[model samples]
Target: MVDAYLSLGSNIGERETQLQLAIEQLNMTPGIRVKRVSLIYETKPVGYVDQPDFLNLCVSIETNLPPFQLLQACLEIETRLHRVRKERWGPRTIDIDILLYGKSIIEDEHLSIPHPRMSERAFVMIPLNDIASDVIEPRSNKLIRTLVQPDDSVVKYK
Candidate 1:
């Protein structure tokens, strides 16, 4: 089994509930095992910022699925949650991203492991530090906590 990290976010329809439901779905996936989860944070939205604030958290899982296969599973979970993506980075009921795949550096049309933008987002960094502060970003070779910058602040949701 490989240790993988996934980032979850939601900005629509009971945001925290959406995140919890996503985690539930992930834990139920055949090849995935939910190992650790960080505290949910209320975060300011990024990219297209006109939407509602999001509830975000990071999850660590043990999975036997390949990177692409795992990516497919995440997408499936989002779809199962009735996610509608009419715009780029638009608000959604659930968004699950493959942040790290057992230190694997993957760059493909369908996915990018270590999530190209994870370091720059407080929503990702704060929770990532909670669970995997020692884990390094594959490309940067630096701890995930070290990459955090204070552009945005995140608050504990519970």
Candidate 2:
């Protein structure tokens, strides 16, 4: 199975519960097994500033599914938790993003492994550092820990 990392966030009703349910669903998927999860962090909305603060965390998983298939599974989980993509970076019950897929660098119309913007988002990097600090991000050829930076907008969720 390929080792993969995913970032999950929620800002709608019961934000923390939404994240938990998504994790449960991911673990329930036949080809996926969650290996570790970071402590949840509360982060201010990034792109769309009008939304509520989000509960964010990252997970490391071992999965046999291909990148696209894994993306499909994440999307499926979001839908199950009532995610509505009315706008980019809009409020949602749950948002799951594929951050890294093994040591692979992938760029396709449907998905981008090592997630295109992960390096720039402290919200993604901080929690990712918790679970996969030494994991190399293929595109940058740098360790996850090296890529993380302090950001006031992100803090541990109580």
Q: Which candidate is the best by TM-score?
A: 2
Model 1, span 47-154: residue lDDT tens:
899999899999999999999999989999999999998999898999999899987998888888779888777888888888998888889999877887654479
Error of 2 at 122 (Å): 0.3
lDDT of 2 by residue, 1-158 (tens): 99999999999999988999999999999899999999999989988899899999999999999999999999999999999889998999999999999999888988988799999999999999999999999988989999999998899996
lDDT of 2 at 4: 98
How high is the lDDT of residue 81 in model 1? 99
Q: What is the TM-score of each candidate against the true structure?
A: 0.95, 0.98
Q: Please, what is the whole-model Cα lDDT of each candidate in the order they appear?
A: 0.90, 0.94
Q: In candidate 2, what residue range of length 10 has the lowest lDDT sum?
A: 105-114
Report backbone clashes per prediction: 0, 0
